[model samples]
Target: MSRITLENIHKTFGKVKALDGVSIDVKDKEFFVLFGPAGAGKTTILNCIAGIAMPEEGVVKFDGEIINLVETAKRNVAMVFENYALYPQMTVYDNMASPLRSDLYRQNEDVIKERVYAAAKMMKMENLLERLPSQLSNGQKQRVAMGRALVRTPNVFLMDEPLAHLDAKLRNAMRTELKEMQANFGTTSIYVTHDFMEAMSLGDRIAIVNQGKIVQIGTPDDIYYLACNEFVAQLMGDPEINILSGLLRKNGDNYSFLSNGSEFVLPADAALMNKLAAYDGKSVDIGIRPQHVMYSFSKDAGYRDYQVYSYESIGNKSVIEAYPAGHSGRGDTHTHVRMIAPNGLTIKIDQLIYIDFKLDHTMFFDGSSKEFIGCYNEAGIRALSAGKEEA
Candidate 1:
């Protein structure tokens, strides 16, 4: 395994800038993930590492040595792409053995057979080794692609959404297998995926990329709890985080958030209160995750009235999307918020309900910049970020 570094990398294609001043230090034997929406340059970073696409500026290094000018074969990097780049006419075993048969990294037949079977077993495709790529399902073909890469002892493993084509159940299973494989192999790996769950579960450290730039880099806990900005907070959660437009006000030795015709008393944590003092009497965006917003079917004392906009089932749980009482659900204000509810709840459009914000779980962001200011558990989150850096 090798420590990989890309410093001040800049890559452009005509008018589009794919990577802009991107720098990252992937520790030796670490599983680092690049996470972002599509068209956000995740794949470009992989291509740059593989030597398939050279950066216009900056250097790519392996174990502290420059490898930017090195040929692809010399780089010794195994890449598993999203498209399952397998040979149509070759059997699974042949496809995996092809890498070892190549002149650049050739091995004897016995060695090739042993490595191929081992990889196939790890991928749970040992029985399918003799089947041609054309005779396999999309998921099976993707596994073959990964198996082929696993047969090589490369300096680093670059996987670009390797399980993107698998069904949800299979994807979940493969995710577990991949995590175990990484731990057992102890190989330096860079994985790119837009799935937040995969990023959180598989990566030792995750770098959030957006518009060809690094937004934040930290462990899953750091990113989920201490998001650098609104964009990142929304990306890391399901049902999306509610960005409530509100004002910060001092109410006699306490801070309160005013939003959507209601006032929520901010938690009296000393750390959060002290940091919020600077934004007094100013607008701020309060981030409330769906799970933190509570709902009551009937009228309640502290809960405010809302009309149901939509209710959709997600697996075993459901999300209730609601808007203010009078506003049209169609392109109105930003008061619309989502809350997680039980799957069997009987709900209807425009049904009246009461909801309350859990101020203790809210995150504050600057109104203008839309960047994170602080949250209720500011000190704990800061400690987590600091600990990750130290590690």
Candidate 2:
């Protein structure tokens, strides 16, 4: 295993800038993922690393050695693309063995057979070895492509949406299998995907890229819990984090925020209030996840009362949609706030309901800048303003 590093990388296609001084470090044997929306330059980064495309500037290094001048084959890296990229005329076995047949890395016939069989077994393609690429299903053909990449035991692995073509069930199964394969081989791998779930599950560290720049890079928990900005906070979670506008103010000795006419005391630290002091009268966006909102009976003790507008039971859990009387105009007429409920909760649309928020899970941000102000804690909210104290 080896570390792959990109420093000040830049790439452009005619008028479009694909990569803009993008840089990331893939630790030895770590599963690093590049995640973003479409046209975010994910594939361009992979191509630069694979030597398929050269960057206009910056260095590509493998384990501390520069490799920009190296040929793609000499880079000793394997890439599994979205399309199966299998030859229609070749059988699964032939496809798997193609990488080993290269004269660049000569091995005896027995050695090649052993490697091919091992890769086939890992991908569960041993039974389909004799089937031609044309005769196999999409999932089976993709397994062959993965097998071909695995056969060589390269220093690094680059997988570009390898499971995109598979059905949901098969894709899930392959996700588990791919993680296991990476663990078993301990090869440094770079995975690129638009799916947030995949990035959260498969990556040891993820770089969330946007518009040819890395917005954030950290472990899944770090990125999810401590998002760098509003774009990232909204992009990383399921059902998406809810963003509501509010006005911050000081009332007596306490600090509170008002949304429409509804008001709540700030549960964050006084220092954080000071940090946000400048935006006192301005609109700020508050974010809360679906899971953090609790649903209860109208008379439940310690519950803040609310009214249910609509809801949908999605099997194991229910999505309780409600409307804040004060913020009614800001929300959609059809749906306002949504809370995930436990089973056996008897609830109906337009029902009188009550709910409470998990203060610890709340996040605040500057309305205009869209950057996180701080995270809420029992003592109050703690500011992450280490260097920007002036702000």
Candidate 3:
């Protein structure tokens, strides 16, 4: 097992900053995920740790010792790239056994065969052992690359979108195997990908990176239930969270948000009041995951009016999108409200309906900073930041 650390790493390509002060402490035997969109620096971080690319600033450490000056060959990190970097001339057996034959790990022929066979089994490539790289399909080549990495008993495993181009079914299956392989090997590993499902399913912990910065770091639920900012919330969800811009209103001793003709009652929360004190009556972005939304045949308890612009049924779930019913001429023309519910409901586009916000399950954010202000508890009264208010 290895404990890998990247301290305030900074890297630049020409005028573009690839990574900026990104720091992460990957625990021993932990499966850490670096998740972000393309060009967000996921691969760069992996390279920095492997000594493939040196950071302009900060230090890279392995098990408490600085490895900033170490050579890539001496780092003892095994990397499986999206593009299979296998030797075309070598057969799969030779490719998988190459590491064992190297000076770093001069294992006997019998031991090399044993390790290669074990890795081939893990990657489901036992039958493709003798195929050359050119004779195999892309997916088969990917397994070969993964098998090569797995056969090595390296200090850390760096995987950069290793399953990205596989078919959906194969990708899902690999996720399970990857998790199991990491557990059995207990090798400190960092896997990078743009897929939220991969990160949620395989990571022991995840770091959400964006535009050269780490936005938030936590478990899948911590990021889903409590987002640090609008970007993180938007990135983690499929249909995305509903973010409405409005102002907080003072109703005697109570408070609520009024957007067009729709009103979202604020949960009774002192912490929320404190957070919103400065911005009371000013615009704030209200975010609610689509799943937390509930529909009404007519105006029911806590139901607000809306105008459905579109309704879609996708297998097990249906999505309803709308804006406030009476806000047509109020200048908020682009405001959209969406709700996700179990499918098999009779609904139509252009229909006027009432929907409940489930306010306690909703999230509030500062309009200017786009930072989470609070979310109402299920009891309809407490609040927390994207991480429950940073307190």
Candidate 4:
């Protein structure tokens, strides 16, 4: 096992900055995932560590030793690219054992055959070892590529979207297999992917990178529940987090929220009030995950009024679209709010609906800066009170 670290890394391609001062630490035997949209510099970071691409600035270190000067083969790192990059003319047996031929340790034919078969068994490709790459399925070829990487027993494994070509069912199956492989080997692994589900499921720690800079690094729970910024909050969730525009204003001894001529009183939290007070009469953005929005049949309940606009049933759950009452002029536009409910729930399109805006589940951000103001709940209230008392 090995620990890999990138320090103040910057890579430029002509006028385009591929990586801008990106830094991250992958602990020994840790499965770290680099996640973001395309062109976000994830591959650049992996390349730097693999000695495939050198950054104009910054250092790549392995176990406390700088290895930027080392060649790709000497770095003892294994990389699986998105394309798999297998030799079409080579048989699966030869493909899996190809790396062994160039490895520093000399192995006899029997040893190579043993290792190749073992890797093939792990990937469920043992039966197809003699098939040429062109004759295999996409999933089969990917497994062959993975077997090649596994046969080397390198210090670190860098996988860049290795499962991108598989079907949904096969992709899910591979996810489970990949996690098991990582656990059994206990090798330090850095995986890069644009898929949020894969990152959330596979990584011990995830780094959300953009424009070459790491925006946040944390466990899946932390990144999901306590995003460091608006971009992180917006990027990590499915159906996307809903961003509602509103205003913060002082109302007597408390704070009030105003949006599109609608207003609501905020809970008493000196700290929270103080935080909002800074943005008095100014626009702010509030984020609410679909799961946080609750629907009820009762009109007198503690919830605002809305009208269901549409319904989309996606297997296990239903996504209902709604618009706040009296703001129809906001015009079938930004008024659309999505709510996720169990499959059996009885809801109709264009029906009157009531939603409890579980304020405790909301996140506030400064509209101008797009930075997190506070995450809802008692801790946010406490932090707000602490900030107020300090003032």
Q: TM-score for each prediction?
A: 0.96, 0.87, 0.89, 0.88
Please, what are the lDDT tens digits per residue for candidate 2 over residues 214-288? 989877776777788889998887667877778878776556778746677766566556666777777787888
Q: Identify the leading candidate in terms of TM-score.
A: 1
Residue-level lDDT tens digits of model 1 in 95-195: 99999999999999999999998888888899999998999988788889988998999999999998887888989888887777766666899999999
Give me the candidate number with maximum lDDT.
1
Candidate 3 regions exceeding 4 Å error are 134-137, 252-254, 269-274, 326-334, 344-346, 378-391
lDDT of 1: 0.91
Which residue runs does candidate 4 get wrong by more than 4 Å?
103-105, 250-254, 267-282, 326-332, 344-351, 377-391
lDDT pick, better of 2 and 3: 3
For residues 1-391, what per-residue lDDT tens digits would candidate 4 score against the true structure? 7999999999999999999998899998888999999999999899999998999999999998999999998998988987889988889998888888875755788999999988888888889998999998888888888889888778899999999878888998888887777667668899999888899888888999998899998777667777777888888777678778888888999877787666767767665676777888888988889888888778865677888887777777888878887656246557667788778767776778887676667778888888888765647555554553243
Candidate 4 backbone collisions, by pair: 271-384, 271-385, 272-384
| Backbone atom clashes (below 3 Å) for every candidate | 0, 4, 4, 3
lDDT of 4: 0.83
Per-residue lDDT of candidate 3, residues 62-159 (tens digit): 99999999999998999999899999999999999998899977899999999999999887788999889999988788889988988888999999
For all predictions, the C-alpha RMSD in Å is 1.7, 4.8, 3.9, 4.9
Q: What is the alpha-carbon lDDT of model 2 when measured against the actual structure?
A: 0.81
* Residue 144 C-alpha lDDT in model 1: 91
- Candidate 4 at 283: error in angstroms? 3.3
Scored against the true structure, residue 305 in model 4 reaches a CA lDDT of: 84
Clashing pairs in 3: 226-386, 227-386, 385-388, 385-389
Q: Report the alpha-carbon TM-score of model 2 versus the true structure.
A: 0.87
**Candidates ranked by lDDT:** 1, 3, 4, 2
